[model samples]
Target: MSRTLLAPRSWPLAVKVPLVVAALMAALGVLASWLVLANLADIQERNLRRLADVTLGTLAASLAAPVERRDIWETFDALDRLTATDSGMPAVAMVVLLPGGEVLAASDPRRFPTLRRLDEPLLRAALRAGDMLFDTSRARAVATYRLEEGGEQLGTLLAELDIGALLAERRRATVALVVSNSFLTLVMAGVGYALVRRMLGPLSRLAVAAERLERGEDPGELLEPPQGSREFRKLFGRFRAMARAVQERETILKRLAEEDRLAQLGRLASAMAHEVNNPLAGLLTVVDTLRRRGEDDGVRRHAVELLERGLLGIRNVVGAMLVAYKEDREAPGLTRRAIDDLRYLVQHEVARKRLELVWTNRLPPVLPVDGGAVRQALLNLLLNACGASPVGGKVVFEAVAEDGVCRFLIADQGPGLPADMAAILERSGPPTTPPGRGLGLWTAATLWQRIGGTIRVERVPGKGTRIRLAVPVRVRAEVV
Candidate 1:
């Protein structure tokens, strides 16, 4: 029961609320039934006792003369009149006794064949109406009264009431109580079920909406408008807001992922240009040597061999480029040559924009870093800075290595980061940029983070934006 109540998905609000209400109603019904039955029995017993007192008091008054005069015929005649007057009374037998405690006459001799001596308990217990002794378990009330005339004791009267009619009435009352309580429980259950279902209907719809959102389906109609109380409407509003936020985050992640892929492709192109250009330059040098000194066979043979090797190297570079597009390749560690190659590849873009590219490289050779990927990330940041800079504007590119970490910064002579971008950077989390901004910066941030690094954006002096890219050479432990 506890587990069921705790896991709301298993037992939804629609079912739980009604179950609770039904439980309360059932408890109330049991209590009410107990009280009703008990009170009814008490009332029946009190009414039976009152009837006995009244009937016995009147019979004793009429029997005083007959009992005192010791006339058996008159006493029996009065007993017959008493029974005939009210047949409904539980009066089965009547007897008259003398002051000496001797039974003088009995209305039914068979019921009291041994009534020569009257019962002393019944005689002693006749105090008042409320004090009448009644044996309710046996459905019997024996009332004994001392007959008197002008304060003089005449004789005694003993009446034995049957009490069967009172018992039957009590049984009927019990049946009626059972029927009424059963009806009330059913009514309560129906009303509770209806009210609970009505109250929680909106929540049910909200659950459906949430499930659809989880499945990446639009919750168009489900979140149209909320009904019911103000609290529920407010709750609906909050749910809609939360869902919208999740949707927006998902969109940002998708766009950032695509941008990252595009940035990698761009890197491959740049690296290919650098690789192919070197072999082409070598082939050109070999051709010039052969053209100038073709008379020497040895020189010609050496030049031909060098030319063939350079051409083969270019073929291998092109093949590697095709393979890189088809599958992932091992990442090479950063080196001076790789940095120089990247600088050479981006010179065309910088010259086209006529921007001053302040390239600073301060790092030892053979740094333990993913060269191609880091180059891509750095290239993206540099490209964005150059694009954002005005003509003849300076794009500062700086790189350094220290303490098993690489630090790279790119500052552009353009307006600082946009307001929205600044807000995103101020909130510390995984780097994310909204749509329609610079895809290059978004790609750089994602690539840096994927390699277990952090990216920070700063507003440089003179209305330019400075972006920092940091990557660890190797993971290390830290003391808590």
Candidate 2:
């Protein structure tokens, strides 16, 4: 998870693009600063070497005659003059040695008295020819030169040059480079951020338009065409086209649903007429018998019994239909009777197919769920199963409430359900209506989803298809 969060690919383009640009600029700045500092240091070192050579050569030529004549005053005077000069090199101290390595004269006489052999490590190390050493710890450079008169070595001169000025200049350059590079990096980063934000403006607007479309609102007039690159304009065009198509499709679906509802109502009306007419015919027979044999006690008793049964049958059929079709908001909570009402509701289709139905209900007397929705969903599933079953085939339906959930199962003994139809039950959201097909299954699935239900389908080869629905039990407050 940390890797996922830190991964650059997952970063938003607004941040990622500017950060990359800033990083590249910083790297280039650092490289440029390093190169400039290195080149400056090299030039400064070269100049220092050249100055050292010139200063030492002049000092050595002047000192050679004085040391050969054993003139301490002249040697001291020459050393003093070299230190006093305002040359670029800051000479701190100088010492002249005789041919036998004895100090002839010194700029600091107390430190190196006359005729005393030079014992200082720094001065002794500089006695070799053409050797220039820089002592960074002390911020000084030491140079040595041998005094010669007509191809004869007179003595040696050692000079210690102060280099604080050169070091100070390099420090100033470093500071300037760092400040300028940092400022440049910040400016470039800000510019990069602005450009990226402007480039993504169209995408942000497109996203808003998409959100509006998702909520089933009209996006065509509300969303302006994006004005940016060709790609962004084309994308907005395609999105507008898709939104129109979606709106049209939804309009057609609503129309189709209305038609399907009317068709279902017609079928129910026909079934109810058939059921009521049969009982009415029986009532007619009973009425005729009662009128013809009014004084016969056994005939009157049988007539009354038949009248009661026929009226009761008609009432049950009407009541079941009402329960299945009642508005959900006005319907009572789910109950055993509401679940059982589905049996009567689908009886017409069952009879038409000549199928055997084995129904078992083990629910509590009442449940905290929308009874009308459950009834409607179950009615559709039962009707679908009855239609799928071959003549004389068996369809089974079972319902039970347990563990805070109510489960319903319907199985039919016929050819297995098609894969596409089975997918309607297995999908997560509302089932899409196939063109003029699978409307009943779609309605059942949609109703199930409305009540927070899940569906599972199982197909057995050479047998049939089974669908199970599981709905969680809602609380009383939630049911309302």
Highest TM-score: which candidate?
Answer: 2
Candidate 1 per-residue lDDT over residues 1-480, each given as its tens digit? 998778877986667667777778778877887897788778876776677667778788788887778888788888878877864567767777777767777878665443376554543464334254666687777766668888988776777777777778778877887777777777877787888888878888898998887655788888865654888888888999998997888676766666666676676577668778877888888888878998899999999899888887676656544533433335446775556455544555677689888888887876777665676667666667777788888888888898888888888888777767654533344556676665565556555665667777888555899888788986321100
Model 2 TM-score, 2 decimals: 0.71
Error in Å for residue 67 of model 2: 9.0
Off by over 4 Å in 2: 1-12, 43-47, 50-87, 90-191, 226-234, 283-310, 326-337, 354-378, 390-408, 428-436, 444-456, 459-463, 468-480
Error of 1 at 279 (Å): 13
Residue-level lDDT of model 2, residues 55-108, one tens digit each, is 888778777778889999998998898788887677888888888999889899
Q: How does residue 157 of candidate 1 score in lDDT?
A: 72
**After superposition, candidate 1 runs with Cα above 4 Å error:** 1-10, 33-39, 66-77, 84-88, 96-104, 114-130, 133-137, 149-156, 227-234, 260-480
